[model samples]
Target chain A: MTQPTLGVWDVAAVSALLLINGALSVWLSLGIARQLLVAALRMVAQLAAVGALLTVLFGAASPIWTLAMASAMVLFAGYEVTARQTRRLAGGWGPGLGTATMALAAATVTLVALVGPLRPDPWHEARVAIPLFGMILGNAMTGVGLGLDTLTTAVVRDRAALDARIALGAPRFEALRPVIREAMRRGLIPVINAMAACGVVFLPGMMTGQILAGAPPGDAVLYQVLIMILIAGATGLGLLGAIVGGAWRLTDHRHRLRLDRLAPARPAS
Target chain B: MTNAEILTLRGLTSTALKDCNLTVAPGEIVVVQGPSGSGKSLLLRAIADLDPHQGAAWLGPLDRARMSGPAWRRMVRYVAAEPAWWADRVGDHMRHPKRAAELAVSLGLAADCLDWPVTRLSTGEKQRLGLARALEDHPPVLLLDEPTAALDDAATRAVEALLKRRRDDGVAMVLVTHSDAQAARLANRRLMIRDGCLRDAVS
Candidate 1:
C-alpha cells in the first residue's frame, strides 16, 4: 500500500489553494497578495530544485558529492544563523563562529549516527548520509543561531552588569554563566518541545513522511526516535559551542567585557 | 614606585585619554575635575583594567601586569556613576549583604533597603548602594566615577562623609567629579582633566 506519488497536477491542486488566500488578501486590501504569490512561487521552485538535486545526488552516490552537498547545506545554515542575529559580533565573527560550530556539531553527530547505529552498507552512502546530515544540520542550525542571538543580545543589554561583575573580581566564564545558561535553555527549548509533543500533540514531519511512504509504523517510530535523539545531541553540542565561542569572543584574556567587539545593533525590521 | 603610594599610574593612555600619569598615596583622595566628556571616566576605567590602555598601574608593590584582570580589580575596584544591578533585590547584587547593609545604613539608606526590589531604588539611592556595594570587600584602591552625581545635598554630604571615612581607613581613591566644593573638601591633591589631558589644577 505505497502512497501515490505526487504529480504536477496534484501539486497544482495544492497550489490552487493559494488563489483563495490571494483573493481574500485582495478583498481585504491586505496588500500581501503579491507577497503571498511570490512566497508560494519561491517555495515551489526551491523545493523542486532541491528534489532534482537530491535525485542526481542519489544516482551519483559518491562520497565526495555527498560531502559537497552537506558542506553547502552547512554553509547556508551558517549564513542563515548570522542573518537572524540583530546585533552580531564585529569583524565577521558572527558567521565565522556560527559556521564553525554548526559544521562541527552536525558533522560529528551525523558521522556518529551513520557509523554507530544506521550502519548503511556504505557508511558514506549519499542516499542515507545526505538526508540524515540535512536533518541534523537543520535542527542544529536553529539551535546554534538562537543560542548565538540570545547570547549576543543579552551581553549587549547587560554590559554594565557584566562589567560590574568583572570589576567585582568575577572570572569571565563565571560572570557569563547566567547569560550562557539562558542561551542554552532557549536553544534547546524547541527540540525539547518537539520531543514532548511528538506522537501525541502531532506526529513529527519525518515520522509522518515515513508513514506516508509506507514504512512500517514501528520502524518509522524507531527511526524517528533515533533521529530526534541525534538532533537533540547535535543541537546541545552546537549551542554550547556557539555560546562559549561567543562568550570568549565578547571578552578577552584580560577579562574586560569587550562590548566594543559587538557591532552596533541594526534597527529591528 | 614610592612605598607610600598605594595606587600609581604611569603613562596610562586610552583611545580617548592620553598619557595620564598619577599617584594616590594611601589615605589620600585625588579629585579629578573636568567638563563632561573630558575622558575622566576613561582614565578611571583604564586604571581599573576595565578598558584597553597603554600604561602600567601598581597597587602598592604589585604591578597590575603580573596579576589577572579580576585579581587586580579585586584590590582596585571601579565604581561607575550609575552602577548596574543584575538581580531583583539589592542584597542579591552584594557579595557581603551584612557588610553592605552596614555601609548602606551609614550612607543614609534604610536598614531594610537591601531587601527591597531594585526597581524601588531612586537614582540617589542606587548611587549610595553602588558605593556600598563597592565598599563591601574593602578594596584598598577605589576608582570612583562621579559617585555623587545623582544625590541631593544631604545625601551628597553623607556619601562624601563615607568616602572620607574610607580614605581615613587608608583606602586610596581617584575620584571624578564636577563639584569644586566637593573636590576641595575631599581631595588631598586636586587635578584637572581637559580634552583627555590631565594636569595639576591651579588652585
Candidate 2:
C-alpha cells in the first residue's frame, strides 16, 4: 500500500499538534516549551538541508561526488569522535588515528555491502553508497571514541595497578589486558544493545524510514538486520583498531607507559 | 646463583634524588631514612626503572641499558608503601603460587588466603600478601618503601624476619623507612636523604 504524501499545509497542520504539548508544559510549569520548539526547529532545518543535498546528489549519481561526500562525512565523524574523548592523545595523533581507523572500517564494510549483498545496477549508486557509508562510519566513530576514552581513563585511574603488573614481570599486553578488555566491551555495547532491541522493543530508525518510504515491512526488517550486523562488525573492528593504535602511541619501544603522550583530562565538576 | 652481586647506582638523578651514587652488595641491606615527601619513594622507583631518570644503574655486570624494563623490574622489585594488586584473587598475581604460599605462611597469612578475594583482605593482610607476591619472583635486589608501615608490632616483626631471611639468602635490599628501630635492626649501612643528598645517618 502506498502511503499518502504530506504537502506543505498537511505538514503545517500536523506540526501544530506540538502546541498541545507546549500548552501542557506551560500549565505544568515545565519550562521546556522553548527548548521543545527550538529542538523541533533545529531538527527540521538539519533534515531539510540534508534532504536537499541528497536530492541533488541522487540526481547527479556521479561516483566521484559520492566518494567525495563519503570522505567528508567520515572526516567529520572522525573529528567528532576525537572531540568527544575525555583523554585523547596529545597533538595530532588522536584525531589522525581516529580518522584513519574510521575511514578504513567504514570503507571496508560499505564496499562489502555494495559489492556483496546490495549489488546495485551501478556499483557506486549514490543513494545506496552514501547512506550505508554514513551509517557505518557514524557507528564506528562512536565505538572508537568510547574505546579510546575508556582505555585512557582506565590507564590514568588504575595506573598503580598497571605499573604493579609491569613490575611483576608482565609484558605490555598482559599488563593492559584488563583495561583493554573493558574498553572493547564498552565500545561494542551500543551496537549490541541496538541489535537486541531492533525488532522486539522498537523498530530501528533505518527500518522505519524504509517502511515510511513505501518498502514492505519484511524487506525493511531484513535490511535493518543486515545493516545492524554490518554496524556491529564495523564498530567492533574500528574500536579495536583505534584503541590499539592509540595504545601504541602512548607507549615506547621499551614498553614503558608514557603519560606525556596523553593530553591531561579536566577534572569533573 | 652468583655469589653476592652488588646493586650500583651512579650519577642517578630523579625528581627525588640528584646525582645519587650508592651500592649495596648481596647480603647487605641499606636503610634510607628521610622526612616525609623527601623523594625516598621516588629514589626507589628510579632504581626500579619505574620513573624516568638520568644516570645509570647496574645489577652487578647487567646494565639497565641492556635489559628490558620488565626484565629490570623483575631483578629489582619495588614494593610501594601502598601496594597495588590488579587481580581480584590474590593468587592470580603470584608468578609462583607454591613459593607465594610459603612466603604467605611465614608472613602470618594463611596459605588458603591466596584464593580469597583481595577485597576480603585487611590493609595489613594486603601489605603482607603484596610482599609475598613480589618475593615470588625471587628478585636479586628488592626496593622496599615503608613496607611494614601499616602493620602492628607482631605483623611488623613477622615482615622484618622474612626480610631478614631474604637478606641472609644474599638478596641485596634498599629499604626506605621512617622507623629508627627498623633502620637500626636491618641496616648493614644506614643513609639519610636530606635536601635530596644521600649522607650517612648520624649514629
- The top-ranked prediction according to DockQ is 1
Task: State candidate 2's TM-score.
Answer: 0.92
**Candidate 1 chain B least-lDDT 10 residues:** B1-10
List the candidate 2 regions with Cα displacement exceeding 4 Å. A8-35, A267-269, B1-4
Segments in model 1 whose C-alpha atoms lie over 4 Å from true places: A267-269, B1-5
Q: DockQ score of candidate 2?
A: 0.68
Q: Write candidate 2's Cα lDDT for A1-269 as tens digits.
A: 66968697888788877888898999999999998999889989988998999999999989988988887897788789878888888888878888898789889998999999999969899999999989988899888888888988888888889888877766677788888999899899889888887789988999998899899989998999889989998898888898788767766666667777898786422
Q: How well is each residue in A71-109 modelled by candidate 1, as lDDT tens digits?
A: 899888988988898889988796899889888999999
Q: Give candidate 1's iRMS in Å, 1 decimal.
A: 0.6
Supply DockQ values for each candidate. Answer: 0.84, 0.68
- How far out, in Å, is residue A10 in model 1? 1.3
Measured by lDDT, the strongest candidate is 1
Clashing residue pairs, backbone N/CA/C < 3 A, model 2 = none
Candidate RMSDs in order: 2.0, 2.5
TM, chain A, every candidate: 0.96, 0.90
Docking class of 2: medium
Query: lDDT, candidate 1, residue A250?
Result: 92
